[model samples]
Target chain A: MNSLIRFIQRVSTTLLFLVLLFLSLWLYISTSYYQKAQFGRLALGLSGRLAERVSGIGQYIRMREANIGLRQENVALKNELEFLRSYITLSDDKTMRYSRLTLFDTLNYSYIMARVVNNTVNHQQNYITLNVGRCDGVEQGMGVVGHDGVVGVVLAASARYSVAISLLNTDFKVSARHRPTSTFGSLWWPGRSYTHVRLAEIPLHVALAVGDTVVTSGHSAIFPRDVPIGSIVGYEIAEGNAYSIDVRLFADFRSLDYVYVVRSADRSERLELEHNFSPNAND
Target chain B: MIKQLLRYLGLAVLLFALQLLVFNNINFHGYVAPYIYPMLLLVLPLSLKHWHLLIIGFACGLLMDVFMHTLGLHATAMLIVAYLRPFVTPSDTSRAYAPGMRMGFRWFLKYALLGILVHHTVLFILEAFTFNNLSITLLRIVLSTIASTLFILILEAMRVNGSER
Candidate 1:
């Protein structure tokens, strides 16, 4: 015991240094492919029940806002139905000809409702827990949107709960476009703010306005084309030839409570196309 | 002893819940974030066995990890912090020891800063594992360290005030 105490006293700092080095290395090695999807599902189930019970006490505080949201959603859905009616003949002909269709098959808007069970907003990479899971047809790679704008993508799902990778995370990347010209670029969070994202790799010639709309570019199957992401708050040209844009997100993260998980019906076929053309497509 | 254990357990629950729900939202200009949960680990008894301290700290961090969805960042940081805590703390047998002790601001500041530095360095590096932007990683370490220390000091002050006669 005396010898052990002496050893710890002598080498504790060095030992700690080594231990930290090892753990940091391990975290780096396993991060990209290390997904605990099943664990997330079970955790979601437990947290869902717990959040429900706890939130029940404060449900009254949120009732009014929720009601307002529902009424607005109803109005939006009605308008969407009216728009679809205007395009029903074209959609019918397109649907009959194309055996495989995508959610972006048309400019129509559809949504998958989900409740926020657990949420963390103050991390470099933040994730939200949703009550809808695989049982509710929620799947990985689907986009999650709030009433205002893009929330995140479904990273993992279990039977009763799923995990969303928020737009605020540094690890999250999306193909986005500016309105009017429809020029393409990538949208990513710099992990510095909840209200903005850094739009990368746009050419300097692409015209941009301070309040121009940023929407999903439809380059991927996760989100449909023209789903609102944010508005251009500002822009700066890098030392290189690219224009970096600052987008102010429409989602008020502090008041975020509900979301819609968007799944493309043709996810597998679109993935197949990208896989065939690309050298390393499996990621 | 059982009652005290229950009290601490309840406190742990409250800390974790509050940290996730309330405190996580209170980002002060994206530079400072309060880490009040570590107080649960900090206030643990001084006489605990070294291995036990390591285990408890691991569990404490694991709980936080489960909520944050980062598998091992907090666990790894907390373990090292726990292992090194006793040495950095004012030794009871040394000249710095004061009996019937209330650890003052200076001592708490030094101790908490050291621990936060260690924790944030490991965490930020782990998050930015690719060495993509070493400067940004360093910035995170400094910013998070300052934030956590501020949190620890504020909580300590509040505790001292409430307990003072």
Candidate 2:
């Protein structure tokens, strides 16, 4: 014990240096916004690879359940596709056909399939790491969605991996429309539950009911219009003249396995146009 | 020893206040903000124990981090400067090496300049956490280092003159 003390004293300087250095670096990387994202990008790539391998085993076990879900989704998509095809063919007027065509043509959105290698729902600012990245065209600021609904936005992307700020994060806010009322409000997680988010800025007079559907407003380029956000489950009068409505999200964040990164073809063009004209546009 | 401790405590508080309140807001073109608090570690009594210096450096940095909201950046840089202080200062054991005490102006300049450079480089680099903008980062480091060194030299000159009076 005496010899140990002497040894420690002999190298206390170096020991202290290493200990303090580690502590400071940990604090810096975890807290600072810029460093946190950079560190997340590097750390996510390594940890995401490990997670992907581990989840691979879990995926095999859940294959039957996943197959059932995929089949049901496929049937629903096929029905919707058939309906759209019939509607387009039945419309005889050229102006009506061209207007509908413009809707699909102007959207110009693409989806990149990715596996959710790592996910968290408990942290104040939770992040999900995907198995796809810049090489797969998953850039930062791209929107991410699950099979059920809206998921998150990509925060940083590396060569082989990308980290996204989950919808559960307090910092994440999305413009959402009340489907029944057509009223717009900002949807944000209140850090209470993963399944719940609060939709704010909805005026008090707007008729809100339980189970009323909510969706993306498409005011922002990150997400497309009508992407399911959640449905209203509860509400209360906010401090101001607005109603803060609680929404039950459709995406089961706890069971997330696969996701899609959304890329709008004209995102840059639209953003650049807004940047040039909008006086308050700040990147 | 107790008196020396109190003196440094007072100096630390003063420098912390000045750095947080004044120097931190003096950003020029969003690239340069002179950090003068490092002078606290630079001017510590040379004979102080190494472990004490390290602790003081860490605490000083942590305190700055808490105020500046740059959690570990300041602490890490300050700890490094503290560890490297002895190596850069004059090696003579017979005389005190406190700034302007017994060291020559040239020696003090070299010591302060090296310490500030080390502190600022570690700081800005850690804050950036990426080399993607190497040019901008280098520009910030060079500009901040010069500003900080100039501030330290001016403070040291004032201290020396105050003592003479």
Candidate 3:
């Protein structure tokens, strides 16, 4: 009995270390999903207050550049609005009927403007933080896009702030299509260049030219039809008999300052339909 | 014993504060950022049992993860490094690790780099949660390890130099 006690005393430190390590590892595994979610909510709410304080300082340095971009965007939007007005006038009867059907009916999607407080383009799973949050009606699974292109989907949100898993993250994927041919593929980051991504599962026979514009497929209702994704830079036939094409992303993730969170109007209806189709499956 | 615990507490807080306020904010064109807080675990008194070392490491990492909103990533990396620390701490038993003692720079570099490398490898892999782009992952791990090791060396050297003067 004394011998066993002596042995126990001798190895107690090692056993304790093992216990601590195992406990921490379990904590890590369990928390990787749930705690990241819960902590992200609490952290985005409280710590994002501090993140805002820091980004408030950064906003000053970015003001001049932001002004230039906003001015350009303003000019582009004005041109688009003018073009729409002229087009509507030219097709007066049909446009009037369409507007009458939808007017005061329902918006297909609406955007909530939010300032990006912090953004990272370098990590394997990069994330972006926005100044607006649950208080502003931001919710998990909502799509976020920049002025020029798709950004990412919302991962978690709190009262005062929110975090989105950026397109640069390995965990993120977007369905994209070649503008000319409408051949759709999956867009993902290769985790190499911050300004680049890969479009996969595009069949090899499809005609793809360098600089061909790519846009969201609209297959999923997350992003609306015709949102610009990027342009193709190179292509090669790879495994699974699909073209693995490199894309030069249009949105400059490094300089992202403001973005829009899109709230889909009829997503609930679509989800309900899908749920009814397969009652046992998760939506 | 209480005094020793208090000192470690102060040091841990200082290290965590520096990491949160300074190092994390500094991104060098998306290539490198020195994670200096692991040095807190590295330099804690050698007299501490391995159990204390591991618990402190877990807490320190969890704290960092909480602030960053990356819950488990840092904790996993730190736990491994802390568990392996006593095994890889020193080569020359004469000087071993006095924490404040001036050890040979090369030996010190080798020791610190190993810890940083181990920490970074686990951290980045779990952060990506995939091995699809092994090259990019390797690049991140290597660059971060070098930057962090350099920071650790410089900090340790400064402390050692300060005490002598």
Candidate 4:
């Protein structure tokens, strides 16, 4: 017993290191999947406020660039409004049940406006912090988009703040199809180049041209279909007869200031159907 | 003792604010972020208990993980470097330096860079979680190490020159 105690005392540093390594690995794997634990929520609540204040200071310095981003978004929104407006027909007849509801009456998705309090593009797995959360109708898996296009999906949220997995993150992939022929592929971050991502799994038979637009397939309940993602800039065929495409993203993640968190009201309904097919469908 | 602890705590909070607010927003392309928070562990006194160092490592990393939404990845890497730090560091018996005391330039650079290397290696590996692109991950580790270590050394030099508070 005495010898065991002596040995423990002699090598306690190394021992403590192993012990700590174990504890840390345990803690790491637990949160690797982004479970909304209490500690994460509390830490985010505290740091989110501080970051919000600090970023507010930088907001002044970049007001011009920020204004451009906002204006670009406004122009995009205006264009969308123009497109939607074109679809509406003026009917003075009494039988028309409520005029001016044609374009929006079938919208299964609603948007929650939020400001980007914090953002990053450097890490392999980057996350964006938003100034809105559960109380504001932001939830896990909600899609966030700027004026240009997709920003990311909500990872977790607190009462007043939320963190989202940026499209830059490797773990995040969006199903997209070329706008011309609707050839589908998956978009990946490529772990480098903030402005470009590699669109993988494109079959060689699918005709792809430079400047081809990539938009969401709407196959997943996370995001709506036909949402613009990026445009094809370059591509090369792999040895296995697959096209590795380089896409120029429309949304500038580095300068994200304002975004809208949107979720389909039918998301639950879609997932419920999958759940019937597979009990662990959500997982 | 309480005053010193308070000072250390204040520095931790300040560095964290700088990290989350300024550094987090600065990314030279992708996979090249300067991680300055681990410097808190690097500059601790040699005489401080190793267990205490481990605790601080976990806390610093956990704080970052919480804010960044990586869960426990940072904490794990922080713990690894903190545990290995004392072994790799030069022996400092009879020196009696304070925890945050500025060191000689050459020695400080070597020490900080070593710690940053160890920390970044573990961080990028775990962050990658899989050896999918070994080359890119290694490049990220090395580049981030240089960037973070250089930033820390400059910060330390400034502190040493400006009254060493």
Which candidate number would show the highest DockQ if scored against the true structure? Answer: 4
On TM-score, the candidate that comes out on top is 4
lDDT of 1 by residue, A12-128 (tens): 755655665466446535765226333445466666666656556656787788778778878997999887666554566776535334433653445678887666566777887
> Candidate 1, DockQ to 2 decimals?
0.32
Candidates ranked, most accurate by DockQ first: 4, 3, 1, 2
Reported per model, the fraction of native interface contacts reproduced equals 0.19, 0.34, 0.39, 0.73
- Candidate 2 lDDT over residue span A184-232, tens digit each: 9999986556789999999999999999999999999999888998888
**Backbone collision count in every prediction?**
0, 0, 0, 0
lDDT values of the candidates?
Answer: 0.73, 0.80, 0.79, 0.81
Distance from true location, Cα of A258 in model 2, Å: 1.1
Candidates 1 and 4, the one with greater DockQ: 4
Candidate 3 clashing pairs? none
The TM-scores that each candidate's chain B achieves against the reference are 0.84, 0.93, 0.88, 0.91
Give lDDT tens digits, candidate 2, residues B1-165: 898788778878778766744565455544676899999998887677778889989988877664443558789999999888777666675677465534777887877888888998898777666677677778878888898888888888887787678
Better of 1 and 4 by TM-score: 4
